[model samples]
Target: MRRVLAGLVAGALLALAGCTAESPKTDDGAAAPTGPPCLPAASAAASPGPAPSSAGKPLPAMAVRCFDGGRYVDVAQLGNAPTILNLWRSNCEPCRTELPAFQRFVTSAGSKVRVVGVIVMDSRPAAQSVIDDKQLTFPMLEDRDQQFSIALSQVVGRSVASALPATLFIAPGGRIVYTYQGIALDDEKIRALTAAHLGIEVAA
Candidate 1:
């Protein structure tokens, strides 16, 4: 009973903070299934599958799926700008709030920072539903097997933590300078984090 109450409290706090909950499961005790249908896309600029070679190391040489382009591409080939890779899923509660904020940040940041979205812990349809609902026009990818999440958790502290709604700040040479472990990362926090850690000042 105490454990259940603790979990409920934690969930409520996470929802308030706009963070993904831990290990969402289904009725059959399986992983949570996809959410809903993806809305019509506004542009044709999504990326394809990116299989990261090193989960927790510098930018992994991987290939991710792109929805708009309808093909796969190498993650290292995404572009040269310092990147902000955000992991999310359709079924994630906090993702409902965080993704839109990320979209706004991407639009305002322009070419100054490379912002990419990677769908985690969800089916393509469900993840697409969140994208469509949020009207996000950023680059999207997928990590269906949770390899990146495991790798990242190992790197951070050897704890098996889910990487959904997490943000990785990669420097120019693909060095991951910092990783935001919390939810509720808005434009202001993103800008401050980049400047403080990545040394790049993002203008308002």
Candidate 2:
């Protein structure tokens, strides 16, 4: 009986020692209190917030290259007109689906706003073929280097890694009034937003 009691006492002491051994240690070999690590004040302050909207302010000076009629042109000479710049590629399915609706929107938008298409990630022949096949009657800009896409992505606070079929509605003063990313743009949505923002009724 005494031996059994001794064994029990020894086992209890060993278990207690094991538990203490598992406790975290500090730099000086003292027991370290356990909780979340401390974060710097700057790190706490630097926590990301909601992304800024493109319409929040006027656009910074940007060099936009575009294809007009059958020639390449610079946006700097395009003068001050409210413009809707659409980024698309021939292989993008959403782009293909949204083109017709966009064409309709452009036709109805009239001279109040200019709708420019920037073709990216596509061969010249492929992009031209799509334009020809669709009978698109708007100014198209070739972005073989994707510079326009990168610039727009930075403006909209989005990653450049994201796919195309993006739209940016720039106000007369060069402020981005509306930015639509992903998903096919609807005719009704575009018309309503344009009318409300630009004070022009888009014909259905």
Candidate 3:
């Protein structure tokens, strides 16, 4: 119990400060890692369906990389379909609780909407462990420098909260229809938001 509380506290601190835990290096001074690769976003070329009302501010022009040291992903191009982008950390209790629900949502969502995750201010190994344990198959990006947070603040026209489990609902043209911060969402809430903001209905 004490360890769990300590982990929670550490996660909160990391989220608020945008700090990363030191990654262990190998004998040859290279990083040795484990776990599956963070998958890429679905094909932007394939049209999910008709576009939603692209009335909101576009996501900031920035590029983030896959969590498994894979290719860079353009943040602004994520709106090939309606999207739910979630920011989380491994040590965060709420994130741990919420990610499985997201996985479930993605499993049930089919091609109607896309769900993406970003590991904010956390080490790749730490984040990967959670992903592996949860069996999460959604595409994940990494925000090591907090550029994503800064960009998000610009979109909101203010300093957004430095909190774990932030969610962004994006439209077809990369427009952000809604942003939910400082709260962990469940499958039901995720579906409701998708329907409300992106006009994509996912069954509960």
Give the best candidate by TM-score: 3
Show where candidate 1 strays beyond 4 Å. Answer: 1-57, 154-163
Could you give me the TM-score of model 1 versus the true structure?
0.65
RMSD of 1: 16.6
lDDT of 2 by residue, 128-160 (tens): 677777777776766667776677667768743
TM-score of each: 0.65, 0.64, 0.78
TM-score, cand. 2: 0.64
C-alpha lDDT (0 to 100) for residue 159 of candidate 3? 51
Compute the lDDT for candidate 1: 0.64
Better of 2 and 3 by TM-score: 3
Q: Which regions of candidate 3 are displaced past 4 Å? A: 1-42, 45-47, 158-161
Error of 2 at 128 (Å): 0.9
Q: Which 10-residue window of candidate 1 scores lowest in summed lDDT? A: 35-44
Q: Which residue ranges in model 2 land beyond 4 Å of their true spot?
A: 1-55, 68-72, 76-79
Sort by lDDT, top down from the best? 3, 1, 2
The per-prediction tally of clashing pairs is 12, 0, 0
Each candidate's root-mean-square deviation in Å?
Answer: 16.6, 22.8, 14.2
For model 2, what is the C-alpha lDDT against the true structure? Answer: 0.63
